[model samples]
Target: MNTEEFNNKFDEGQSMVDDLDLSKALRSEQQLTRISIDFPV
Candidate 1:
């Protein structure tokens, strides 16, 4: 393929990776809580 085509594909792939990184960062910023209770029979 030509240089231009290769560059375009590379840019697209890079953008997808960047978006994934951003989503992961955003997910890490959220708060989560869990609780468990047990009962005896």
Candidate 2:
């Protein structure tokens, strides 16, 4: 969909998931990582 249609849908409070490719989408400035930590007394 063009930007105008997408914007209209968003402004109308409609769900936009069906028109989006979320697999490659990420929130701005966010990083995902898996970490492991060990501590010994």
Candidate 3:
């Protein structure tokens, strides 16, 4: 594949990985918020 094609594929893959990481981070944040709310003292 050409450099342009490789760069496009690499960017796409990077975006997908970023999206996955963002979702996981949001989910964990939500869980932490819920736990904190539940255990408020």
Candidate 4:
């Protein structure tokens, strides 16, 4: 990829990483479940 394309992708990935939230969502039973990270390296 060209420099600009690489930079754009890098910036987008950085933004997504920065915006990640690790808090568990509560159900009616109030159980804490783990979040899945499915990204491939």
Candidate 5:
């Protein structure tokens, strides 16, 4: 469907999961960076 149609469905709180095309969806890079911290009591 077009953008307007998609927006209407989303605005109406309808389910749009089935209308999505994720065949080439990209996976976000989630590399974690470690941090060092010291706390004094």
Candidate 6:
């Protein structure tokens, strides 16, 4: 493939990684809320 195609693919992969990171962070926050509610402080 060409340089442009490689750069596009790399950008897409980075975007996917960012999306996955955000999803994981959200899920973690939700789980923490649930745990705090269930256990109390």
lDDT of 1 by residue, 1-41 (tens): 56786679787775445324455465565788888999998
In candidate 2, which residue ranges exceed 4 Å CA deviation? 28-41
Give one clash count per candidate, in the order shown.
0, 0, 0, 0, 0, 0
Candidate of highest lDDT? 2
User: Residue 31 in model 5: shift from native, Å?
Assistant: 7.9
By TM-score, how accurate is candidate 5? 0.55
Query: If scored against the real structure, what TM-score would every candidate get?
Result: 0.32, 0.59, 0.32, 0.32, 0.55, 0.32
The count of backbone overlaps in candidate 4 is 0
In model 2, the Cα lDDT at residue 9 comes to 100
Query: Would you list the C-alpha lDDT of every candidate in the order shown?
Result: 0.64, 0.93, 0.56, 0.64, 0.91, 0.56
lDDT of 5 by residue, 1-41 (tens): 99999999999999998998889676789668899999998
Tens digit per residue, CA lDDT, model 6, 1-41: 56786679787775445324455355344553333346657
lDDT of 2 at 12: 100
Candidate 4 — which pairs collide?
none
Per-residue lDDT tens digits of candidate 2, residues 1-41? 89999999999999998999899987996888889999998
Clashing pairs in 3: none
Mark the 10 consecutive residues where model 4 has the least summed lDDT: 13-22
Instruction: Write the number of the candidate with greater lDDT, choosing between 2 and 5.
Output: 2
